[model samples]
Target: MCNLIGHALQQALTRRGFIAGSAVGASLIAPMMCSAVAGDDELDTRIEIAQSSGDTASSRTRLLLLGTAGGPTWWPNSDQCGISSAVAVGDAYYLVDCGEGVGKRLQQALLPANSRVMSANLRALFLTHLHSDHTVDYPNLLLFGLFTGLDRPASPLKVFGPGRRGQVAPVFSLPGSSSPTAPIISPDNPTPGTKDMTGYIYQAFATDLNDRMRDNGKRSLEALVEVHDIDIPQIAGFKSPNETPAPPMEPFRVFEDDRVRVSAILVAHAPVWPAFAYRFDSEDGSIVFSGDTARSENLIKLAKGADILVHEVIVTRWIHGLFPAPRSVAEEGLMQHLLGAHTPVEEVGGIAEAAGVKKLVLSHIVPGNATREQLSPAGKGFSGELVIGRDLMQIGTGQAAAPARKG
Candidate 1:
């Protein structure tokens, strides 16, 4: 029986497949019923919590977890590898990454369409990079927000990000523009189907935006979703920069309101250049987010002594052990590429330790082997508090909470 169990474990290690984080607990187990959604449906009208005060003894800051997508495969129970960290600097919500199903998740989290993340009253969105997992829900944010009436305020959705801002120009309402398309995986449209998702998305809302403009006797809807494409440099050797200034990379700073200051630094996740690690600073405390990266000094530098480090990781030892056997070489190569592009668990712990973060939350998890038990081995390397993230699992700002025991 022991030998048979060993064989099954061997097979799991050998399977070559992409993994992603998903909601396994309440998100899946919880009924899909939207009872809370039925009531008033006002996003900003929900519960309120006191925020931590910052510098000058005048302002306060808070953060809310929206979407939790990680792992190599998106769980049927959860969405893909997308996470939105919304920070409240006094009275605004600044979104970190808008991934697939983010709209629905935000609704579930009850962050109303146009309401600020905190009680203060501001709205902003920031994208860490343009990976499919990170930005797949880009258009949905606009379409859904408008339909739900969240985009009706005077303030346009303030967007910030790294690189090629509007270079591919989002499919706009204006005619004569080339509409954006996506590959279709259905047999009806046989020729390697490329369906225009954005076009369809806009079509769904074209009537509303137009009709509203006519009713209001204005050029357009009361609130228009604005896209500000920030440019992140696509450079080589950013991992080991030999020179100062680093070619004018603009770190993300949400506000200069000295009460609460947020900053970002670029980290390595090649061939996706200019990945970011963001830091949130208030007088009382601070938190850092490692957007999506492998091990790098830049992240360590960015996270230095922050309250929390929300990081992404891939299991290396598990992958190496699993793929060195009989299988397609092409599959093996792809698997190796993924492994190379992400942080191993040991390195995740090391990053946290070196950065001196008060606590460590391991996110964007790519579990090489099934079961959380297999992942505990990584804790041997990281002594600080470690959390194996699950979708919608809320965590508080830094006061060390011990990691859950391995199953």
Candidate 2:
């Protein structure tokens, strides 16, 4: 009787294209079926629903997840891209990071890609750190914005991030190389901060910028971008790479406009000092982004009373399961680095609890394409609204606080 019931159910699902010949086939078919059901109109409706729930759609701030994968490497046939997000307030948008493939993702989010209004509305980009995964699309975003009709920003496009870390020890030595114990080489001066990096990027694109200006009558890209290097107060135990120590870890304002006021705090993503977590406050509500960090009290404090706390998370269980038990020295070292730099999923709940945040949205998720069952272990302690972030998910920041919906 059980076999007969199972067969009937399978047949029903197969007819609906939600399943195929076997369970393995079903897994593939299910997503396709879901895509078919949720067409572009459905996606727009989802966004509209979230936007319309509050006092007025125009007054509410919307959070859009552009990418949700954890690391720099994008696996073949993966649904998500790297970690990036956008906060939309009224007509303008503020990007959080420019992870891999962010330009395409942004085009999808802001439809009618050639619309001058849409392109120009991309006001500022705030970077949490200088990790390759997070900044992979920096060039793409900077160049493509012009082609998309972003002529001149209201103000120079502002980019904010932590200052550079001084030279540090190398993580690993090349295989078969002599002097494996040699320390990493460092220049006489400290590492370049965000402002210097921005200048470098501009200079790197000098030829392109020049040609575009002369041929297309375009303005200089350098005239459009401005970078700010945040110097947060050093935590008692922590040291910054700057020659002079930073002031303190208090909530310091980074940017402000009529729509939102942004503040930042230093979070611990060691070996990469001066990592930041940002808080955005508007009349509607507040949202905190816990950029990339391990367990951090500073992050908790920054997120305190926030309407939404978007935190990065890693599941150690899944990570361990990815490799065989008798690990090599290199594998062990990699594991140690990952474990130390990222927040464990189990601890995420505690941080949310301590912060008293209303909603916890997990992004930069390690082991991309993780299922809810796999992520459940992380939510053991806290009971606030938990959301497993996905690319193109949109959430409304308002008193009504509509549940996040896939875009």
Candidate 3:
């Protein structure tokens, strides 16, 4: 039955064309990529249902596994190239990187009820960096939030990330596109970067807001969407090649309300400078979401002893083996970037061990095409509890508030 189920799941994954370039030795490898039934619409309904039942806890410190696989470049099917990102539930809704399909995933997980993520409430979007796969949904989230009524004048939202004026503006508000161009995001510093993507995201939404309000009855687009730029690299540290001049790292505190507190630090995801990892500490427990990074001591320092370290992982051996011969030089060349850009399974374990974290949630799993053995490399290296995350999988941190243990 397990084999049959695996076969079925493999078929579903292949139909989506999310397969990798390598050929698998067995059907078992195929099952790793299963169909995630809960799309954004579905999640939205669930949240609405949960809220209507007076279940505020549903929107509490719960972590919703929205998009687990990375880099397929499309939606759930686009698993190959995308990096991992997630939605964290707190007093207000907080989005980890808005990767590909994240808007839809958020839509599926939010909306419908009079909850915090309804038509006009947003906690903030915490970003690790500006990788295309990790940030593809930036424009979508901004546009959808406004279109779906989630973003309105009264419900200004926020987007946080490392600042890069040249890279962010194009995506935040496309040049010559109908969207409103924002004031340069990132802020003044000796490092030379923007405030954050918030301003640019809002500027992009401006044109959409005008069209929506003029077309519909909604008034005041600015009220609906608000942007708070966070200079990540300045506070954290920018990773760059030693031979080249490195952009100064900027890491800073984003928010610290009674409900949750967020802090960031820079990590090494070279060539692509100014990457980050965020630590969201709440009363119940804490979670550290690594944006997209190779191995880094900096990340371990930031995540020390946290309940969950939501980090990205890749199969180093399998990736290297895929193009092992002289004939596959081109393929090997391509793998180098991915291999070097992401953390290997053993590295994840090492990071967890060094940080003294009790649990590790491996996400943004790369080459979603690897065998089960290859896919779950982190499990073998770490003795502490480890989770090979799947979309929609929820990890609980605090003990289910129970009656006091009878002493």
Number of backbone collisions per candidate: 19, 2, 37
lDDT, candidate 2, equals: 0.69
State the lDDT of candidate 1 residue by residue for 1-407, as single tens digits.
00001111111111110011123323332332122112232322431211211111122343444555554346553332366656544444566777766665554433433444321233656666656677677677764565554444566666555542112212222244455454544334322101233334456678876775677443442245445544444545433322321333445454445445768777665545445677777665776888887776877887888776778777676677667767464555466556766777767777888888765765566651223444444454555665544334334453222333447
Ranking of all predicted structures according to lDDT, beginning with the best and ending with the worst = 2, 3, 1
| Cα lDDT tens digits for candidate 2, 96-188 | 988886876666555542344445777788999888888888888887777765677557778888676766535554467554454433354
Q: For residues 197-309, what per-residue lDDT tens digits would candidate 3 score against the true structure?
A: 44555576787767777887665535655555554333334333332213334335677767678888767676565667888888778888876788777788788889878
Higher-ranked by lDDT: 2 or 3: 2
What local distance difference test score does each model get?
A: 0.51, 0.69, 0.56
Over 4 Å off, model 2: 1-59, 113-117, 169-190, 234-248, 399-407
**TM-score of every candidate:** 0.62, 0.79, 0.68
Q: After superposition, how far is residue 249 of candidate 3 from its true place, in Å?
A: 9.1
Off by over 4 Å in 1: 1-62, 71-73, 76-81, 89-91, 111-122, 165-223, 231-259, 317-333, 368-370, 398-407
Ranking by TM-score: 2, 3, 1
Model 3 scores worst on lDDT over the 10 consecutive residues at: 1-10
